[model samples]
Target: MTTSATQRQAAASVKSRPPRIADRLPAEGENGVFTESWFPLCKSSEIAPGEMRGFGFLDGRVVVMRDRQGEVHVLSAYCPHVGADLSVGKVVGDQIQCAFHEWRFNTDGYVAATAIGDPAPKACLFKYPSADKYGVIWAFNGETPWWEIPDFDKPADALAIRVEYDVPIYPIDPWVICANTPDWQHIKIVHKIAFDHKQYRDCLVWNNYSMQGRLDGYYTDNKGGALETKAGIFGTSIFMMQGNIGGRWIGVMTPFGIPKPGHTSTYFILATEKGDGSPADQQIVDQTLAGLYHLAKVQVGEDKPILRTIKYAPGYLTASDAMLAKYLKLVREFPRSHAGGEYIR
Candidate 1:
């Protein structure tokens, strides 16, 4: 073969070779493993008093329950003795008693009690580093301790209206929703807004974004609407749209994702009209929840299946997917294991 033919064959061979697994994974040095960051796993309402529920978050099975004092505790679903599911146990006072062998664990995951005949288990159930903040339970599944849970308390306090809708989780990776916030073209096409064209046109240009460590923030057009929104993508959580609407309505989208062993679930808390003097009365909260449920059923339900089918091609990104790239970048920076960090309640 001629020299050119030989060079062409070598290039083709290199192209045909399978890429390394490390290349397929998110860049570790840049994004860090996500397991260490604080991620909102479940709403406080989801864990009723004395009820133990199994959930997936941080790519593992976690059992969360509320004690008689109304505080939440999260630990491995499996018991150390005989591998029974801790979720099946009863919540007694602050301790969770294993239904199988009656091994009990306290709120801090210490072995409180065990059966007389059973040998003391050498290993304890893996306890998740958790904190209760803003009516939600935040857990860290990574190797390093999360510094501080992102504060949603201020927004929650400011809103005159607070709404929570328990819509069916769209079976899509959390990144899809993260990507949607900044994707302007999809808003006009999918949402079908009949609003101002100039706003939509300007948002498509990626001009306002700043990244600091694990957090990144950006502002985009609310599709010519009265809403001006900003999104702060933190590790796996989304803190989006923290601005006023119509000079009165303050809105924020605090998005969270929890990964189970077999599936993933996501939810958001929308607080509007923040910093207003009016309190979120019971009636207002109720109405907000109802409206959110309706809106989610229409919007998230529509986006769910479509997002579920999206394929993430390795090393392929377009300028239009700037938000997604930013999200992926943050994800890569989180730690995979909890090495050292204090657990705050």
Candidate 2:
């Protein structure tokens, strides 16, 4: 077929147009990584006292170390001089010994020791706030995290069962990828979750959320009660809360620091209330465990394939998307990361 003159002109115009990034990403732009939230960085054993570990990402890298008193500190990685890896260094008491030239840096990232006659430059490491909660190490991009990681009531007094996904490293941003929780219609279509009209009617979103519907093919019990889930989220961490929300699963899937744009490692943990430790309570535990197993081992298999290929673009949502809409509103309104310096909390 021969092209018309108008079509040829359009093609030419398209070729001349400069390429640009899509606006589907959050407005935080390149600065989005340093957000005002706590990110799951590592596990407790990963950085015990007198140990140092380093990690890298798209936004920036960080070095995790523990002092003599077992207090953990997460700081921007890389030695100011020669760009040496601070993680490979040794932890001597309250400081990290640089592998490149034996320069010792205190927990504050300041130069603590140098060779005789060597000048102690007025340089220091940039530090972010860090904490250990929910069996994970969280690092805040800012000195003061805006909110604390949500926890259940009397968790230690409960029966906690954990299930994990060898979740493949997906290329999407955590905030964008996690928006599926509120896209109830998609959950029905994508994960085989069954949400009837009333369940959809019960839709709501605040700091947390609840789903009063049947998990359908996701459990042996298949009871709507077993499927009902209460959830907590703050882009840095999102999960189906159990003990706190009267659900079969209580777990989290979160990321680390957002110094720059990058993907995060997500995980899961489930808990059941150990009331009286009676056989009836144990039965509930068994049922909850089975429900979580299907969600983690079987049902999640359905989500991974779609999650990896999802794109951030214009969305056409329906009434059932109330949760996702509110979730995005919160994500969009979060403040930027605090200025670089000492972490307070």
| lDDT by candidate, in order shown | 0.55, 0.60
Tens digit of per-residue lDDT, candidate 2, span 1-345: 457988998999999987764436463335533446666666666777788787653366778888889888887777776677787888887988888888888888788877454888988778777886655667765656666666664555555554353556666666665566666666667655554634443544455222222222232334223344444455534554432223334543433333345565665655555557788877777776566555565555667787678776536655766666666766666566545522211
Cα lDDT tens digits, model 1, 266-327, are 55656654333345555555555455445545666656666667654336456765655654
RMSD of each: 7.4, 5.9
Question: Using Cα atoms with residue i matched to residue i, what is each candidate's TM-score against the true structure?
Answer: 0.68, 0.75
Error of 2 at 68 (Å): 2.9
**Cα lDDT of model 2 overall?**
0.60
lDDT of 2 at 284: 75
Worst 10 residues of 2 by lDDT: 208-217
Model 1 segments more than 4 A misplaced? 1-34, 117-122, 152-167, 184-224, 273-297, 314-324, 338-345
Displacement of the residue 330 alpha carbon in candidate 2, Å: 2.4
User: Scored by Cα lDDT, where does model 1 land?
Assistant: 0.55
